[model samples]
Target: MLLPFFEWCENTAIGETIRNSLWLFPVIEAVHLLALCLLGGSLLVVDLRMLGVGLKGQRISQVAGYARPFLIGSIVTLVCTGLLLFLSEAVKCYYNTSFWVKITTLPIALLLTFAVRDRFSLRKSFETSAMSRLLGAGSLTLWFVVAAAGRWIGFS
Candidate 1:
């Protein structure tokens, strides 16, 4: 079932164009990297705030508010570019272990960031709690692994 979908993705016009154009693939890959960096930076700011390390003296809500737009935008950009990159090499990715690791971790990390960490960050009571610290640390670790796994895909 999934094999057919992967095959279909590889046969799509955009996928074919990406694969055939030597420059297009590299350009998209670079965009994906830049988007990841933006995403990581934005999340790091919020996470560090949650951990009470950075932006000390500022309200958690205030710090998070500053990073929220960039975080959301980067997520959208990364997902779009990531999907395009995946389509360009669907078959190879289908068999890649690092690809699977990244795919699995990406959603988990996103959920930890947007659902768990963001919710806690918005509540003043939870801002300095142990739970907040744990969530902050976990989010950072998850995203770090996600980025590492993504790089490993190139090697594998």
Candidate 2:
């Protein structure tokens, strides 16, 4: 059932149109990389601030506020291109464990972002509280796992 849906997608006008474009895949992939960089970089900056590693003189909310746009932009770019890429190989990715792990971790990452961000906004200190710091560390670890799994998917 799903196979046909994916096949149909691959054969659809839009898919064919994108497939025919000479630089579409490369361009989208480059954008994806750029987005990943921005997301990781922005998050790290904020996390480091939380950990008292970066912007030590700055408030956590201030640092996070400044980085929010970059995070949002990266997420938008990443999701858009990621969907396109997934559609291009939907059936395969649908069954890939790494892809699933990546999917699963996304919510955790989002939750961490909201929780930490909200706390900071609520006048809470961000001086690397044990829980928040753990969350940050876990966030980084999970994302790394997601990327590693994504790479492994190609091999399998």
Candidate 3:
């Protein structure tokens, strides 16, 4: 399904134009990297709070509320730029193991976010439970793997 869609994209005039631009991929990759930094930074703070490592005075909900916009913006930037890059090398990425690992981790991280969000409550939000700390550690590990896998794409 995705292959056909990607094939169509590869054949389109827009795709041709995008592919022909010598600097487009590099520019997109740079933006993706910058977005990654932003996302990681914001998530790190949130995770640290969850792990009882920082901002212990502030409520978890308060921290999450403040970071939500930054997190969403960074993720949006990452998605758009990442898709552009993937489109440029769709067929290759479709088979790359590192690419698969990175793609796989994305959903896991999202699921982790949903789990953490669901676990958050008025009273519970104030207390960083052990489960929350474990979840935070898991989220960090998954993101680390994703980043490492992405870097491996260059060599593999």
Candidate 4:
């Protein structure tokens, strides 16, 4: 159903330019990876706090608040660079199983991070619940699959 759109994206002028350029793809990929790292780190701090591992002294709300800007910024950066990267190889991604895995997991991961995890972490009370540990584990697992699938795309 979406194959035609992927074909159109790969044929876009900017996409062709990026695909043809020696440096553009590499630079964009580097930025994308850096953004991923930033995102992982930002989320990790809060997740660990929720798990009652690190930052025991700080409130979950405080850790989450501190990581908010970084989380938002990294996600923005990732989306921008990811679009450009996809534009360059949309058709290839369409055929790649790893790409399907990434696309499948990415939104779920984001939903967990922002909607469930972030909101849950923001309670004023310092009380840690069993749900917190579940959230932390689930967030980590989904994100790891997303990242790993993204990495597998290169090999695929």
The better-scoring model by lDDT among 1 and 4 is 4
Q: lDDT of each prediction vs. the true structure?
A: 0.87, 0.74, 0.78, 0.92
Residue pairs in clash, model 4: none
Candidate 2: lDDT of 54? 75
Q: What lDDT tens digits, residue by residue, belong to model 2 across residues 14-38?
A: 6666677888877887888888889
lDDT of 1 by residue, 73-115 (tens): 9889989999999999999988899999999999999888887
TM-score of each: 0.94, 0.82, 0.86, 0.96
User: Candidate 1 or 2, higher lDDT?
Assistant: 1
Best by lDDT: 4
State residue 48's C-alpha deviation in candidate 2, in Å: 1.6
Q: Give the TM-score of candidate 4.
A: 0.96
Q: Model 4, range 12-77, lDDT digits (tens) per residue?
A: 998999999999999999999999999999989988888889888988999989999999999999
What is the Cα-based lDDT of residue 126 in candidate 4? 47
lDDT of 3 by residue, 1-156 (tens): 677876765667655666889988788899999999999988888789889988888877777778878888998898888878777777777668899899999888777776554356223445688866886788789889988998888778
Those runs of model 1 whose alpha carbons end farther than 4 Å from true positions after fitting are none
Candidate 1 vs 2: which has more TM-score = 1
lDDT preference between candidates 2 and 4, better one: 4
Ranking by TM-score: 4, 1, 3, 2
| Clashes (N, CA, C under 3 Å) per candidate | 0, 0, 0, 0
Residue 28 miss distance in model 1 (angstroms):
0.9
Query: Candidate 3 at residue 126, lDDT?
Result: 59
Q: Candidate 1: minimum summed lDDT over ten consecutive residues — where?
A: 120-129
